[model samples]
Target: MDAFAIQRQLTGIEPLNGSNYTTWRTSVDIMLGFLDYEFVLYEEKPAAITEESSEAVKLLYAKWTKANTIAIRLIRASIGETIRGDIPVFNTAKALQYYYLTQFMSTSYDGSGSVREHIYKICKLVNGLRE
Candidate 1:
């Protein structure tokens, strides 16, 4: 896509909801790719280039770095609120991955002994294992 289209898409990105972390994360990655920005997942913040870098190069790097930071902040704010106390304040994408894996895929339903409860538990177990 063109620059304007990519910029518009990035600016229009939505915050993540509880159940859509995977979808939202995928969308963000696609948008970043459109803009030629790195996904920056599971990594420390990038280091700035040396003093020998040209003004235009520095500016581009700075803008790319800002966009990466914004993505992480948006992720933490969106997922953190949805998961509540399950996540800590200084969260990361790795933590979100773990939470997504354990919580959403968990099959430990607490239903008491009944036909429906048995069915749900079995389904949950199967789905959890599949995940």
Candidate 2:
């Protein structure tokens, strides 16, 4: 699909509230991967461009910067306004992702709960990690 179509799909993901972290994370991860912006989550930001920087280095820096910016914007856009203030500001997409994972990864299924439901939740968490 074209960039615009992919972007529209990304924006269609449900905005994350306090309860829907797993679903929101999985959707964002898939959309970002399709857009080739997932690298911003794994790759460290390149050094700032300087006047003396080589052409290749400058190009790399520019590419990384664009991806980083887009990824951050997409992530923030997926967040609900009510809880957005609770999340600290993060300049890098990777940092924002790390914060959310740590903040929401914890899950507990009491033995009294439906086995199928607990299993489903576990599967979702596993899928989120795989992304």
Candidate 3:
């Protein structure tokens, strides 16, 4: 599908309020991955281009910059205005992902649930952190 079509579909994802973070995050991750913008979550940003920069270095820098910019914009757009203000400004997609993980991932599991359920929740949280 074209970028515009994918983006239009992404608009269907509900904005993140504190309560819907998990579902919102999964939707955004899948959309970004489809757009090839998920790399900014894993790859370190390349050094800024200089006059003496090699073609390969320049290309890498451009690719990273484009992905980072798009990912940041998409993420900000997905956030609910009420909670968006609470998040500190982030320049990179990875930093934004870390902020969301730290803010949303609940580590404390109450003893009210079955052991299997608790384990499943723990595993899901771990997978989110890994991403």
Candidate 4:
């Protein structure tokens, strides 16, 4: 399949910049699903193009890597820095998503930041629990 065909299927989801990891994760996941790009999240094989691989598989792998690269670019700088070492050296896109979900999804509110930030976190915690 042509790459643009798949790219056109993707939603115009905003890049994640750490301001709202929860929403960003959700949006990106939905967008990826819409584009049928979930393999980048689950598969460990097809890491790179191999001489033995067929042309179709090679194209699919290229799409997968492109999706991952786009996602990596969307990540906010600070968030990226925080997770830089934690992200798997190989097969990063899916691993990065998992890292953010595990680290930020269950964060506790310590009332340490600005009032607005604290309120947002408290609301986030409440919303997360409700979900």
* Per-residue lDDT of 6 in model 4: 43
Model 3 residue 18 lDDT score: 58
TM-score head-to-head 3 vs 4, winner? 3
For each candidate, the alpha-carbon lDDT, in order, equals 0.54, 0.76, 0.77, 0.55
Candidate 4 residue runs with Cα over 4 Å from true position: 1-20, 77-91, 97-131
lDDT over C-alpha atoms for residue 52 of model 4: 92
What is candidate 2's lDDT per residue for 8-110, written digit by digit as tens?
8976799976567778888988888887888888989888889999999998998888888888888888888875666687888777546546645676766
TM-scores, all models, native as reference: 0.39, 0.68, 0.70, 0.43
Best by lDDT: 3
Q: How do the residues 17-106 of candidate 4 rate in per-residue lDDT, one tens digit apiece?
A: 335557656765665566566556667646577799899989988887787766554333224354344344435565644544554666
Q: Candidate 1 lDDT, tens digit per residue, 7-95? A: 67766666554445456667676765665554555455445788898888788677757766665565454443544444444333334
Query: Global CA lDDT of candidate 1, please?
Result: 0.54
In lDDT terms, how accurate is model 2? 0.76
Instruction: Write the residue-wise lDDT of candidate 3 on 40-94 in tens digits.
Output: 9888888889999999999989989989998888888888887667667788878
For model 1, give the 10-residue run with minimal summed lDDT: 122-131
Error of 2 at 47 (Å): 1.4
